[model samples]
Target: MYVCICNAVKEKDFRGAARRCSGGDAEQVYATMGKVPQCGQCLEDAEDILFEERQLCTRLPAANACQGLRGLAPA
Candidate 1:
């Protein structure tokens, strides 16, 4: 999906940028990817995606830990 319409950035692109950027910071992600926020409306969504991506990264290695847990599913 399109994350940043102003920069034509996709979610995958944002994920990659988020990994490269520090602490999952949305602003740093944009600067690291050489993209700048224009309309500014996308920032909230972008930050959300970044947070989700970062959270996923931290949990991925231990994914099996929650395999049988209840209510830990994605929304």
Candidate 2:
């Protein structure tokens, strides 16, 4: 489940980061976790996984809210 093997970041780590990005900025998650992207290969998978997780969580708002500028607000 680790998203970035080089950095030792897990899928849950990415999930937590994505959740924190309620502000609609993945950079916030990256910064908070102090993770540096090594190879760019993980980026797409990380995002896709995060998206799927969010979709599965009914507690979260509709996915669209987290799509554009709307995601800048609270989740």
Highest-TM-score candidate: 1
Q: What is the clash count of model 1? A: 0
> Where is the poorest 10-residue window by lDDT in model 2?
66-75
Per-residue alpha-carbon lDDT of candidate 2 for residues 1-75, written as tens digits (9 for 90 to 100): 878787888887777667555443344556668876787677777767665655554355565434332333332
Count the clashes in each prediction.
Answer: 0, 0
- The per-residue C-alpha lDDT of model 2 at residue 44 equals 74
lDDT of 1 at 55: 64
Q: Per-residue CA lDDT of candidate 1, range 1-75, in tens? A: 998898999988887776555453577679888888999988989888776765675667455432222223222
How far in Å is the alpha carbon of 39 misplaced in model 1?
0.8
TM-score, cand. 2 = 0.60
- TM-scores of the models, in the order given: 0.72, 0.60
**lDDT of every predicted structure (CA atoms):** 0.69, 0.60
What stretches of model 1 exceed 4 Å from their correct place? 61-75
lDDT value, residue 38 of candidate 2:
81
